[model samples]
Target: MSFDIRPAVPPDAAAACEVLRRSITECCVQDHQNDPDILAAWLGNKHPAMVASWFESPTNYSLVAVRGDDIVGVSLLTGAGKLALCYLLPEAQRQGAGSALLRRLERQAIELGMKTLYLHSTATAEGFFAAHGYRRDGNVRSPYGVETILFWKPLAEGAEPESKRKRFCNCNSA
Candidate 1:
């Protein structure tokens, strides 16, 4: 299905959070052995507040993928180009929504003068990120007991200069 990727507004915060909550619960949590408690805690926890704040912050960039009136996917990028969150509803997976969201975020990162984009990928998403040019830097444990692979990629050449961008987490600055 075709979708439109656009900058998120305040009203879209709730919809974006729902998309994120659903994606994590149904998609990411499955690799964790279908633990409903863990999924609920992760998705039902302070996510709404955090997402609302992100949408309101000047340094945090967020995007939503919309199919008509539905928010099918959401992603957030920090000032330093850290890809803090990327999620698509299960029904929307593999339909270009996630890729479209990523591309839109990458374009924003370039416009913000960022050189590299980083994210911590779940076991299910690591391969996806790797295929998209994000190489694993290391494995890390999330607060919920799941281990994630840290991945990062330098944007296309001539997009931005690495020397000017801040490093994310333990990722190599050079």
Candidate 2:
């Protein structure tokens, strides 16, 4: 029932991937419709080795939510403040783990001087992100045909997000 979130080391990649895969396969049934082939295709590029490599890469910052020695949820934030990955196992859902993981990622983004945080949320997770104040910008179809919501939340309170701001260019002939 208790869990802690922490920066992920390379060795945690396998467990993190397991958490992610279980979330996708079990918790996101509506997105994949219980199609094994679709799930396989969705996970083909997300091998544990690739997850480990991402942990070693400078472009990504990964985090894991652990209960005891087991990872219950996982997330990876990119250098650009994009939440490139996030998921919680079925057992971890609705227990404050996902929200805590997101809050941790947002804190890290703010520490990195990011103005906003963005993520593509699966249909199953859209409400979760929305509840945390992420605004829906649009929708996108994944390469494998899963529909996702493009969402972003401003890190600094009351600041106008650049993506939602109006721009005017003045042009005059002198």
Candidate 3:
């Protein structure tokens, strides 16, 4: 099925929340590993109310990938150039929905005059981000205790030279 990427609306909160929850629960087994505690911590704030707040936040730019009536993926970017959230349903994985959402957000960031785009990527998504021109800067332990890779990409030519970009070590330690 063909998918379309569009700006997320407040009414889309519940569907987006479901996509995020399912994508993490099913598609990210390598990260969560069925650890009950880890899963609970990670999904603790993924409620529809919280998701709606994100969609309505002026500092956030959110989008949803849809196939007809179903939301297949959800993405959000902060005004400060952080690709805060990117999740796709298991059925939508490897089907171009993620890429579409990424490209659209990148464009949005550039239009907003952002020179770089950065995110904390799960192990499952590291290679995907690398393939899309994001460089691995370091690793960090997430609040939920997962080791996530930090990735960043320059949004435009002459934005920031790699040599000048700050590189950090693993932040898993105190």
lDDT of each: 0.75, 0.78, 0.85
Error of 1 at 99 (Å): 0.6
TM per candidate: 0.84, 0.88, 0.91
The lDDT, on a scale of 0 to 1, for candidate 1 is 0.75
Query: If the candidates were sorted by their TM-score against the true structure, best first, what order would they fall in?
Result: 3, 2, 1
Give me the overall lDDT of model 3: 0.85
Best by TM-score: 3
lDDT of 2 at 172: 10
Where is model 1 more than 4 Å wrong at Cα? 44-46, 156-174
Worst 10 contiguous positions by lDDT, candidate 3 = 165-174
Give the top-scoring candidate (lDDT). 3
What is the C-alpha lDDT profile of model 3 across 1-174, one tens digit per residue?
589999999999999999989988998889989999988978888889889998998988999999989999999998767788889999889999999999999999988989888888889888899999998877877888788888889888766634443333221210
**Model 2: per-residue lDDT, tens digit, 6-75?**
9888898888878878888888999999887878767776667878887877877888899987899888
Please identify model 3 stretches exceeding 4 Å from their true place. Answer: 161-174
Model with the higher lDDT, candidate 1 or 3: 3
**What shift in Å separates residue 11 of candidate 1 from its native position after superposition?**
0.9
Model 2, residue pairs in steric clash: none
- Give the per-residue lDDT digits (tens) of candidate 1, residues 33-57: 7786666545554356667777888
Model 3 residue 161 distance off true place after TM-score fit, in angstroms: 8.1
